[model samples]
Target: MAAHNHIPLPIGQVPSSPYYIHPSDMNSMQFVSNKFKDEGFTDWKRSMTISLSTKNKLGFVTGIINKPNLQYASYKQWERCNDMIISWIMYNLDAMIARSVLYFNIAAEIWKDLEDRYDSIDAFFTKMKMLWDELHLQSYSKDFQTTTRSEANAVLDEAQ
Candidate 1:
């Protein structure tokens, strides 16, 4: 018989392939717990980003690496990686938030949804700080006119 080139098959397609074994679960302790708090969000984002990047799973969450084409040999491997990433994210999330995101089919959508929900917190705090600084800088006097102006400012600030 003539010698034939042996092309490797994609993972999970071949019953004997070692790639059929599942990957180890990601450690969740390093990431900030998503306690559904606005303050905890920044830490959670930073920690999760670092952890995912370290594991080379950042692309899955960022949508930079898409699922492989059906004809590709790596499709099964990609799916496994995607599922692992999704599980990592879910494992670190607060129960309520996890439930909300449980139905997401892709890691990118879950990442985007969480970002949209929590990323605005910084902006909100910044705006509030600016308003407070402006209020503090205003000169107030004992005179009726100045006192009235300060009162009006206080009302406006509270309304914000």
Candidate 2:
């Protein structure tokens, strides 16, 4: 029989409290339009850069609704984040459908009519190949009342 030595993992790699992440947080939740004089466009851009550059998937758009700042944020800012997040989710669904070679092990080709990424994450999803179906496309609409608090929370928990 051979004796073995067990090595311990580092604390940093142990996955402690990284940061409060909300999917909406990455969508520039506190961002006002470039027109808004007081708007923190810098924060918006910085957040977007951080989101895109992050190695963590949770750091992306999905973190928008997940991350909540203790400091007060305006309704406009929250609205902006919500709008961007919903749109991003729509685009993501569309892209996955578009880029998918197949679904559920079924023989299906969904990526037949979409383009490629233009500039950002939303752009990438928008650019993916997808067949235009007025009916099914409705499912991908932001108006769709599908996403819920628990649902998003579950996703966040799983990712974390």
Best by lDDT: 1
* Cα lDDT of model 1 by residue, 65-143, tens digit: 7877979877777777777777778878777788999999888899999999888876577667776676566545344
For candidate 1, the TM-score is 0.65
Candidate 2: where is the Cα deviation over 4 Å? 1-71, 95-160
For candidate 2, lDDT tens digit of each residue in 1-160?
9989878543223332123234434432332222212133344344534543342322324343243354644333433433443333333333444244223111111111111222244433333323224324645778435767686456445433
lDDT of 1: 0.71
TM-score per candidate, chains pooled: 0.65, 0.19
Evaluated at residue 110, the lDDT of candidate 1 is: 93
Tell me the RMSD of model 1 versus the true structure.
6.3
CA lDDT of each candidate? 0.71, 0.35
Top model number, TM-score: 1
Model 1 regions lying over 4 Å from their true place: 1-24, 27-30, 33-38, 133-160
